[model samples]
Target: MAEEWRRETGGRRTSAARERFERIYHTLRDRICLLDYPPDTRLSEEALAEEFGISRTPLRRVLGLLEAQGLLKSVQGVGTIVTDVDLDELAQVYQLRMELAELLGKLSPVMPDEETLALFRAHHKRSLGLIDKPDPRTFARLNMDFLQALLLITGNEPLRDISERLYFQTTRIWLKLTAHMDIAEEVAVFSREIGDILAAVEIGDLEAAGYIRRSHISMSFTRLKKLTI
Candidate 1:
C-alpha cells in the first residue's frame, strides 16, 4: 500500500512540475518580448526561482525551453544570459515579414469565407482601441495580434510558422524602439490603413491589398529607423 501511494504521489508531482515549467517559460518569454530583461542581462536561475517561488528543477526546465526558443543562451562559465539584439537578424526578420505580409494580402481576397473577414475586423477594432492607451507594450501586443489574424487567412502551415517566428523578433525590436517614442497618432493611422486593407480584400482587389500591405510595412520600418537613435 505504501509503495502504491508513493507511485501516485510521484505521478502527481510530475504533472505539477510540468505546469510550473510552462508558467515560468511563458512569464520569461513575455518579459523578454517587453524588454524587461534587456539585452545581454545575466539571468540567475536561483534568483528567478526564488522570485517566482518555484523550485530549481522547474526553473531549469524553463531555462532549457527558453534556450531552445533562441531567447536565452548559456555559456560555459558565464551562466544564462538574455541574448542581445542582432541588427542583421532583425533586418532579415523584417524583410521576411514584409514578404509574408504581402503574400497574406494577396491570399486574403481568395479566402472564400466570412469567418476570415470577421476575424480581421475584430482584431482591427481591438488594435484601434489600444491606440489611446499610452502603453507601448499593450500596443505592440495588439499590433502583433492584428497581423497574425490577417496572416491566418492564408491557411499555409509553413508560412504561418515562419511568420510567427519573424513577428516575435520584430515585435521585440519594435517594443524597444517605441519605449520612449509617443507615436499614438501613427498607430491610429495604421489601424485605419489595416481596416482599408481588409475592405479591399473583401472586395476581391488582391493587387490593391498587396500594395497597401507593403506600403504599411515599409512606412513602419522607416519610422522605426528614425526613432532608434
Candidate 2:
C-alpha cells in the first residue's frame, strides 16, 4: 500500500509540474508573438528561472519546447534568443498550414455547444468594434483570438496544435507587415473575409467556412506577392 501510494503521489506531482511548465511556455510564447519579447532578444536560463521562481529543470523544459517550435534558439555560451521571422520560411509554413487546416475542417464538427457558440458570437462582435482602431496590433491580436475560438470548437488536438504553432510563427510578421499597411484597407479586408468565415461558423456550416478561409488565405498571399522579401 505504501509503494502504491508513493507511485500515485509521484504521478500527481509530475502531472502538476507538466501543467506548470505548459503555462510558462504559453506565457513566454504569447509574449513573443505579441512582440513583447521581440526578435533577437536574448534571455538567459538563470534570469528566466529566477524571474519565474522555477528551477532550471522546469524552466529548461519550457525553453526546450519554445526552441522546438522555432520561437527560440539556444546558443552554446550566449543563452537563448527569440528567432527572427523569415518570410521565405513563413511562406513554406503557410503552405503546410493550409493543408493541415483543411484537414481540420474535414475532421472538426464545427457544431459548437451553445456556450461556445455564444462565446464565439461575442468575440465576433468584439472584433467588429475594434476594426476602426488604427493600431494593427489590436487587429492582429483579435484575429488570433477569433481563430483560436474557432479552433476550440474543432476539438481536434493535432489540428489545434499545428494551427497554433504555425499561427505563432506569423504573428510577429503580421506586426511588421501592419506597419506598412494602410490600416483602413487591411482592416476592411480582414473584416470582410473574417466576417464571412464567422458567419458560416455561426450557422454550423464548416464547408462554407473552409472555403472562405481558403479564399482569404489566397488573398493574403497575393497581397504579400509584391513584397521583395
Candidate 3:
C-alpha cells in the first residue's frame, strides 16, 4: 500500500510541476511579445529563476522552449538574449502567416462543426469589443485569440502548429512597430475583415474567403511597411 501511494503521489507531483513550467513559459513569452523584455536584452538565468520563483532546472526547460520558438538565443559564454527584431525577419514571418492563412482558407471547404463555428464567431465579437481599449497588451491578446479561433477551423495539425509559432513571432514585431501608434481604427478594420471572412466560410465560399485572407495579410504588410519607414 505504501508503494502504491508513493507512485500516485509522484504522479501528482509531476503533473503539478508540468503545470507550473507551462505557466512560467507563457508568462515569459508574453513578456517577450509585449517587449517587456525587449530585443537583445540579456536574460540572466538566475535572475529569471528568482523572479519566477523557480529553480534553474525548470527555468532552463522554459528557456529551451522559447529558444526553439525563435524568441531567444543562448550564447555559449554570454548567456541567453532576446532575439534581434529584424525587419527582414518580420517580413518573412508575415509571409509565413499569409501562406498558412491561405492554406487554411483552402481547407475551409471541410466545414468545421457548429461548436467550432460558434467559438470563432464569439472570438470575433470579443475582438470587436476591445477595439476602443487603449491597452495594447489587451488588444494584442484579443487579436491572437481571434486568429487562433480561425485557425482551428482548418483542422490540420501541422498547419495549426506553424500558425501558432508564426502568430507569436508576428505579434512581437507588431507590438514593437505599433507601440507608439493609436491602433484602434486598425483593430476595428481587422475585426470587420474577420467578420467578412467568417461570413464567406459560412456560405461555403472558400474562394472568396481565400481572397479576403490574402488581401488582409497583404494590407497588413503594406501598413507595417509604412509604419516602419
Candidate 4:
C-alpha cells in the first residue's frame, strides 16, 4: 500500500511538472511570436527563472524546446537569442504549411461542436473590427486564437503539432513586415478568410475549411514574397 501511494504521488508530481513546463514554454514562445522578444533578443536565463519561480534546470529545458522549434538559439558566449526569419526560409515553411492545411481535413478530421463554431464566429466578428481599426498586435493574437480553434477540429496529432510550429515560426514575419505592407488590405483579406473558414465549418464541411485555409496561406505567401522582394 505504501509503495502504491509513492508511485501515485510520483505520477502526480510528473504531471504537475509537465504542466508547468508547457505553461512556461508556451508563454515564451508566444512572446517570441508576438515580437515582444523580437529577432536577436537575448533571453536572460536567470531573469526568466526568477520570473517563473523556477530553477535554471527546468527553465533551460523550456528554452531548449523553443530552440528546437526554431524560435531561439544559444550562442557560445551569448545566451538564447530569438532567431530571425528571412524570405527564403519563410517561403519554404509557408509551402509546407499550405500542404498541411489541406491535410487537416483529410486526416482524421473532427467536426467542431457548436461551441467551437461559435468561437470561430467570434473570431470573424473580431476580424471585422480590424478592418476599420487595424491593429497589428491585436490581429496577431486573433490569428493565434483562430489557429488554436481551427486545430481543435483535427484529431491528427502530428498534423496539429507541425501546423502550430510552422505557424509560430512564420507568424512574426507578418508583424515584423507590417510597416512595409498594407495593413488595411491584409486585415481585410484575413477577415475574409475567417468568414469563409467559419462558413465552411458551420455547414459541417471540414474538408472545405481546410482547402480554404490552404488557399489563404498560398495567397498570403505571395503577398509576403512581393514585399520581401
The local lDDT score (0 to 100) that residue 162 gets in candidate 3 is 75
lDDT of residue 44 for candidate 3? 90
Ranking by TM-score: 4, 2, 3, 1
lDDT of 3 at 60: 86
TM-scores across all candidates? 0.70, 0.87, 0.78, 0.93
In candidate 4, what are the lDDT values of residues 71-94, reduced to their tens digit?
899999887899998666887899
Candidates arranged by lDDT, highest first:
4, 3, 2, 1
Worst 10 residues of 3 by lDDT: 1-10
Please give the distance, in angstroms, between residue 136's alpha carbon in candidate 4 and its true position after superposition.
0.8
Model 1: lDDT of residue 93: 67
Candidate achieving the largest TM-score: 4
Looking at model 3, the pairs that clash are none
Q: Write the per-residue lDDT of candidate 1 for residues 1-229, one digit (tens) a residue.
A: 1222233244455656556655676678778877889878899978998999988875776677667557789998999989866776766667777787777645533553688778878867876777866567777666766766666556555565566656666677777677566668767877877788788768866567767877787777777777764
Backbone N/Cα/C clashes per model: 0, 0, 0, 0
- Model 1 CA RMSD to the hidden true structure, in angstroms: 7.8
Q: Which stretches of candidate 1 lie over 4 Å from their true place?
A: 1-27, 44-69, 105-115, 204-211
Candidate number achieving the greatest lDDT relative to the actual structure: 4
Deviation in Å, model 4, residue 42 alpha carbon: 0.9
- As for candidate 2, its clashing pairs are none
lDDT per prediction? 0.70, 0.73, 0.75, 0.87
